[model samples]
Target: MPPRTEAHAEQQPAAVAVGKATPAAEVEPPGKVQVTVGGAEEAGSEGEDDDDDFDWGAAKHIFVLSNAGKPVFSLSGDEQRLSTLMSLIQGMLSLCADCDNGDEMESISAGSRRFVFLKRGNLVLVGVSSSLVETASGDEGGEGGEGTGKEEDEAAAAAAAPECESFMRLQLEYLYASILFLLTSKVQGIFLKSPGYDLRGLLGGADTSLRGIIELAEPSRGRGRMLAGGVETVWMDPAIRSRVARNLQAAQTASAPSGALYAVWLCGEKLVALAQPRAPSHHLSSRDLLLLVNYVATQPALRNAESWTPVCFPRFQKTGYLYAYIGFLEDPPSSTLPRPPPQGNADQNSPPAQHSDATAGTGSIADENEGRRGGSASADGGTQSNGSGSRSIERDSGTEAGGAAGDSCVILVSVESSSEQFQAFRRTRSALESRFRSALGTHWDRYLGSGAELEREGILTKFCTQMKALHFHYCLRGKQGGAPCVTQCLSSPFVDHELASNPAAQHRVWGYYTRAALRVRRGSCQEGRVFCRRRFEGNNGYFGGGGGDGRGSGSPAEEGNGASEEELATALFESDPVHSLAYEVGDEHTVVSLFGKRDGGAGGGGRWVSSSSAGTGRLGGGDELHVCFPSSVSPEDAYKAAVRLTAIVRRDRDWLFLTGTGAAK
Candidate 1:
């Protein structure tokens, strides 16, 4: 796939036809094959593809499959069928819309089912399913939701550990809460962290990063059988996530968990947070730098846990303040390592009625004979590619970002590098968060002294200490009956979006972190396959090659002139969320982000003066980039650009027939 040239015109709104799946390319030197870029693509309606009918009966099949008669244990076939059905529906939503123009369609899963839509795009979707025992959705069998509120309230009150309260309540709420009603005509798209957190329906007008995160996720894929079991929101103070790092050190356990609890959640292309744990033994040693460097290469990716490995986000020492690297995927690339900003999602104070997380107001009216679960499409997640020019990465600077990570969680690096790391880190962190939550709930404070809260909760400090040292590396992802998961897009049912053969349109695939994850138009059909597209642009041959010579693919007319770089590539599929949709241009492959690439793609994505420079980061031989809408551009430009893109790759085609059916004869 070519590097993802997400050079859409964001200043103004425009309609953009979908692009295609190209591999993430590598970067070389400038004056060579350069991928010139303009503003982000315009916005347009992504007309829905043909969708398969929803199967409402699978729920019963699932109950039978479990043989336990306990519905919760059984992943109802009906749900899977509906999920597949919804994937088809929302995936092609734009085609169904009356408006010729389209909206952003970010993906978010609230309740049991996953969802697809846009954040600010033209479409929105809301999905609900059952997996979480008490999450926003409910199941008929076993220990699912339907528990008494009095019992839950009592449990919350009596729970000795403050942390435990959340588990008890979270589990129940996950099961019982009705899907919310955030999706409105005005909403661009709603992105739910997961069913557990998505109490309300799809929210309207969320941040662009939310859109970006999901867009980069499965452009059109989901796992109907899988479940992201955990809380959607973490109301605790930010410090808590970091503080645990310092706390790890103070305890002084022997075999400390090699990794810390660093988390990167770019749910909808938003680089949420990258927090590393700090052990008491942390030092500015080479080994530490290596660990940091490894992770440095991590966070800039799409933040999809399924594809990459995780690093215990390092922590700071001095102040109880554990510094973490936090930013929105939309932040400018030229800016400094950013501090945490306020939340950017839709209204959450009082979750919607369907998403009350208590009782599903009234049971959803079922058609009985054809029991299709009621749902909607919302926020989305995904994965895709790398794009850019070239770079002879020297080991010296490659480790720059690592050394600078420091004891403080402050991870300072260029925008390009950050984007890549964001992709990888987000994925790992999401997996960790989900797994950790499940572990703690199932183990019931297995780590005794691990935390003050756990200590007080009647868990042995020794056990807690031991528990904190290790983690759930997602070893069980595919342990069910076969090998483990390989990429983010291929997670069994819940995440599997039957791969479509159409061009790379909105919310079609599951991996790589780009905006594709959020663009489900509605009524799209699945092709059931993983795909790869290779697209390279012949540089102007600036690297001593013939000027204006075509080196990549396409023809003379397509190549054009003005020293355009090769079309960057990206590997977008249907599964995987919170990962990066990478891109690289010019001779330098560093991420040219609005935050740091102030010189435009000029300076090699410079390193942080501090430790971020340790590693000579090679982001597919390009600069670290962060897409930010320039205030100058007009929304009209975006609209026009989108229209142009659509025109470039329309779905159907026409040809002159030798003779008309009747008239010809």
Candidate 2:
């Protein structure tokens, strides 16, 4: 039987009456109890209550509409039901254009809420955020304290507004890019030709993907990759990754007329390997790659069965579409397959073990069987017991081995679609799958296991003692004259006791990092300069006072003499130790470092000297390095720690980045 497609699944009734069940009577006369229909009393009441209780004012809202005031999509609430609000937004935009002498409406601030408008051809996208810190009212302050305090507050508020709006605009751009990715940029022309056209119809059911993109855009989710505009690669053994890449290349070469332009392998959200055309210009851009990853991840139906869909890489070529063949590698059926007998108990009738060195003389049973069977095992392949113990051997035509049931590994191949070309490509896909499986041995079970080993050997653990932050994100841009690539690494302690016990501290730490990232990307911050900001001094203190005196040793009293409140605050800001820092190193690189609260007062005093040569000299001119440090660590110590971390990353660049030739050498 063919696999059920999403549309077919959706068309099936949610419930069926197996045994001639009848609906209960709607009402009973007088004192008789009323009969509930379908045995669902207040069936959707909880959902209704959830919708009613939802804090719409607090959550971010994204809306897409036509110039003719037709609603297309809304991140929150139903777009069709929100027609009045959409119409008002359209009218407001029209007023802005009419009153401003044809100028476009970019943003509008009303108290704490800000609305950002982005117009693309005949469509309009508006993003609304209520999370902005409200500007303090001047009337609240006494007459004597009004001047400098209010001015400073106003300046800070002004700085924050633009940053929030800029990020909102970026979110809208991603939303619009997602639309263009689904239906090429020609969508604009479609709307231009017919102003009253309903775009939602053309979008089919892509709103789910757009909603996912919005969720990822949230500060607490997606992390630095969303902010840095890069893709996060799966961490694997360099040798294994290289072998996978080489096999992908070999597969492409085997099917010479396959028309396969690019092949990508993904283990969940992280990329395992990618093989693009030798031509540098044909590579996928980071933005397009991110969108593609999001699409695959958001759509559960894609995971259910292999799919051939048309996808457009807007950054690659907005005018054209590429046919993508996406298939998930199935795990070998170990239960039904014959297992070799235990060591020392092998039956006399079993064939003698033969060494198989088809690829690199690994002597694996799967490889040996494939060789003996002339590269094509029979329907019922032979099983040989090795001295080690009972082990399952995969047949030549069976599914690939390794990975848990829940684990997902997908292979995506893209090519220009054509009747003859697609048929040829289908055959190539089979050959590629076979070769891909043959390249990976049973060792995948060891490497792709629980991932504890990966975390232990990862950069986070390597420098956990030195850089004591809760989270870290690193991006390594491709070297000069190579294909544009951005390799990313993100780590956070999943087993940290303090973070697990104190949820607020976790939220605060991420907030600090998010704000620092915004500051780094803001236009006001000059390039090649390190940006540092102190964490907020709340009652719970950093890390919920898990260890040590949460406050640092560099207190205002130690600085000598009587100090004013402002002086003390400044001293605390400089010495109390914050969790995040941002340093923009030219146009193509950035380093955002974060720190957690200290454990046992580890870091101490050091002078912070701002140097003009800090970015180029101290940072080692790398792509991006984001780390976390203890809150008790002084700013100067954090800076020095970041420099040390950069040196360590530079030394291991080969293992960290996936470069032009293939996996990192």
Candidate 3:
């Protein structure tokens, strides 16, 4: 498969025609492909192909329409052609509008097709599905035979109706949320107010976002089995989440209006921290958050810098606008080691290019201190110390007057209208960011303990000491086809210290890490098969190759045509959320993120683990990090902390790719 692309435009809203569509097995005329509805398969003629199997029962089609019976959006089929069907649906819904039922419209079943409707003011969300399976009546025998009582069967059918209705309603809600994300409440209001407003034109760019929501809600998809409407959080210790929340809240307080709506910090695409007023009415819907995150993730321009955009939290107010100041934080790249001067003319007064501890094959963890004023690292007692000097904090200086973007957090602050209010908000945000930076610096100092040299002992000691602020960390590094190198904090539940101390046990653990990395890169999850479905199966090819590229059959290592350096780097460092995963594993919460290239494509991905660079072992090729914390932890903190580590990994590639006992040799 070819590597995935960056973004996809929203599909024009439309629905497939209701009918017995052609089956995959039957040979069709040129320019035609089989399209099925429900589970009824087309009887194929002799010599027809039948190898392709699709469960039509799992398919769902969604449509959005105005109360005027005009089509707004559709997830499948042709929109223009589905007007008649939509008119029929609208006509049916009109009859029920004057009934005793309140604003809501419950689902109605028409033969095999179930139509679920949700009325949101002037807009209507409709979900049509032929995949609803018949619920066995309570009176039915375990062997699929009828029970002796007719009343029991009737009661069972009644019992099953609610479940079916609930599922349909949920699907409708998903569609509505997706639309809100694309058009926002304010835009929707505008579209409604204007007579000639083309909702499709307003939703033109959101095709990918809409499709993602549909896939997430579809029962047949892997993510649907795992996540519902809630946001995907980076699992971290509660204490860390609290600290992050405090930071975000503090940031919000710096520039927030008296009625600020939401202040959130996103790491990659998952929400790691959020801050809001204590008012009871300040409830932020998880679905809204999810939708917003997905929207931002699809927007590549928002990744690198701070931007302010007019936004409407549809759940909060569907007809108004709020300005959101969005910015990102990233750990600055490590200062480059000065090149050695020519042997004869080297200046005797110049400071040595190398330190005593720095040697070939030995990776040095550089402190973030060198370039900034009053940033220093000490090696005594294994604790880092900041320089005793005053540092001026500055706000992000983007094209916009007041916003700033950096590597620490994805700051999203809401503000009221008016340039004066925006300027005030920017000042407030800058001051808050300064405070956050200072606090983060202090935290980094405590974690580093003296200097980067402390990491020389090994990956285990490095993780053990650096991650003392929270629970232990589990770090893994591996090549696409080779074994992985893994070391966890001594206190981790997954670690058996006695066995860990054993050389054989250590080798085994290393093997486990290697195998796990391979499995993840290959998208091999069976139970919570989220990545495999979204990436490998769907073949979005954002990082990996496209599925239609006709090369997905080979392993990632075998394909050797992964994303380019810039592409892989962007996937790792950019704000794309779909590339990351946050889900629960048993009682523990595990967040997984893939970095580097593993598309099995030949050249660009070769820079990852085990790939030779200047005849040295590669450190970060095909590397993926998984952090597991107690279920009590939230996913947000987990990601915030993980990204910091990733920043270090990005800088200290030499150390990570070490082949021998000591640094690169």
Candidate 4:
């Protein structure tokens, strides 16, 4: 394989790439379908990671552009390179490897999410299927543009090939897994705040109202029909399932709102399955989920709702990444989505001639620091502090690429919450803001609004509403060094600790995070433990625990009291699974289903039974039961990984740090 690095792409100019068409034009066949940057491929170095640190070398930033050739999203160095490159290949294959039956466009990877936006400043990607993918005359046929119509000849002209789908899936897998993986160094978010360039508009009309943030998009056709809820997936490979599960669990702890909590958990190929009863008041319909996805699509910092409950939550044996982002720690307290001034009808115009100079291989990550003179973070839509928090300019810059005159765009991310239910939310937001300020130190924008003065001058929102109590907003500047995307911070445990330990306010806090395993234990109310009362808003119910668990003590005694025979029988069978060899063991008592839980009751030796049900008159079952998980991992390995992470966090005092040698190799 070739080395994976953005530096390699810099060799080619941003102008006309074979796969990236400037505008719709007539077809001129190349007569061949091939994968080529038409240059040498760069290989990435590898290292052993004993802890959080995996020696990533110097970083670079690369751009991800839409088919129109406008940038959609951007990432730092190596990681960015990998993301963009994969996108290109997959995008090309999407158009190239497709077969059609002459008349309409037929896509192998068809779904509702085929919408494409002409992104200007950020990294957003969409793959579209095309006929005559190799034709170059489409955009050059004078004004209206024309195509050879060679692609429309027949769907049979092409055959379904696995290469494109496989490649695209793998790339999605990487991003869905870790956007920082290919990085030779810690990835930064500096590109998010660059001025001049137009980032895609974050649409915010109403608060995202799933259990968390909802992702919504106004499809060109669907009046309101767009992807809602989480991306459905099938997880079959054991290794992949474990990895995705671990990461998803950790990222959940980082979200601030109702978030993407697992109301229903179905785990097992051979284990006993059952539904956990979630609170009756917390039922969320498919509509509820759709709303959440809609909301998320409009938020900032979060590029996508990656951890939102997946549409296909428990796909038994297929391996893939499923999930979405709902509420984020940093959300818009007010309804002000960030957008750029349109140069005209934005979607219009054949994108600029693919100037070879704009391609990742030839484009320098940063322009000659030339016009990088100082500017106010408050200029137009900028970052500013609230209350007595004097504007420190913390850091400021002017690296943002804008229109012909070369101006900068502004963005504000609200960190503090506006509610009393979460004073902790406010404090943590402030701390994160502070860390961001410090991280960008010399690179912060001088103009714009901070936590307090956003709406006064910048394109921003404040944290406040009937949902909560206070007001807070954060300014994001895409400067030379002010790492902009704070969401990536979830990878740091120490940072999480600092934010989690706010002394100002408190209520229920759990079920959210960005890294590490956060096993949400359904606490017993009778045990008097305070279970953070965040509500669930989906179909699934919660389940698990044996008969003697929480359920055994709560059944009613009325003559008309109802207990379905199926439910009662399940409960009875769980009490003595030893009597039946066909049962799988698991708990069913304290189950709190989110979407929909599993089969009836719990089974396996894992079930708990009271002496009354066991026929042994033991009347004894411990509240705290032990379950064994067989892993190839030794206790020592787990200990080592934990200790290593702790040490790195202590040394760096930052949530993100390097664990392996400082060298790339």
Number of the predicted model whose TM-score against the real structure is largest: 2
RMSD of each: 29.0, 20.3, 21.0, 27.3
lDDT of 3 by residue, 37-116 (tens): 22222222211111122122433667777777787777775555566556656765664454342222344343334455
After the best TM-score superposition of candidate 2, give how far the Cα of residue 121 lies from its true spot, in angstroms: 0.5
**Top-down TM-score ranking:** 2, 3, 1, 4
Better of 1 and 3 by TM-score: 3
Runs of candidate 4 exceeding 4 Å displacement: 1-65, 74-91, 94-628, 632-665
Those runs of model 2 whose alpha carbons end farther than 4 Å from true positions after fitting are: 1-54, 132-163, 256-258, 332-407, 410-412, 419-427, 446-462, 480-622, 660-665
| Candidate number of the best lDDT | 2
Error of 1 at 471 (Å): 34
**Candidate 4 lDDT by residue in tens digits, 40-143:** 22222222221122111211112344333334343333323343343443454334323232111111221111112212123333333222122233234442
Ranking by lDDT: 2, 3, 4, 1
Say which prediction, candidate 3 or candidate 4, comes out ahead on lDDT: 3
Quality of model 2 by C-alpha lDDT: 0.49
lDDT of 1 by residue, 1-665 (tens): 22222222122222221222111131121111111112222222211221232232121111100111111111222323233333333333433232334433222122222222221122122322212122222223223255657655433222211111111122212111101111222221222222222312232232222222222112232211011210011112122222322222222221122222333332221111232223212212111222233233334432211222212211112112222233222211112333222221111122323422221221111111022111211112223223221221111223222221111122322112333444433333333333323322222111111121322111111111222211000001111012111111111111112222432211111111122221111111111111111112122211112133321211111011111221111111111112222222211111111111111121112211211122212111111112111223343432232222212111100000000110000
In model 4, the Cα lDDT at residue 204 comes to 19
The lDDT for every candidate, in the order shown, is: 0.21, 0.49, 0.40, 0.21
Q: TM-score for every candidate vs. truth?
A: 0.19, 0.64, 0.42, 0.19
Model 3 CA deviation exceeding 4 Å by range:
1-58, 94-105, 110-112, 132-163, 177-197, 218-229, 237-240, 256-261, 334-409, 420-665
Q: Model 2, 299: alpha-carbon shift in Å?
A: 0.9
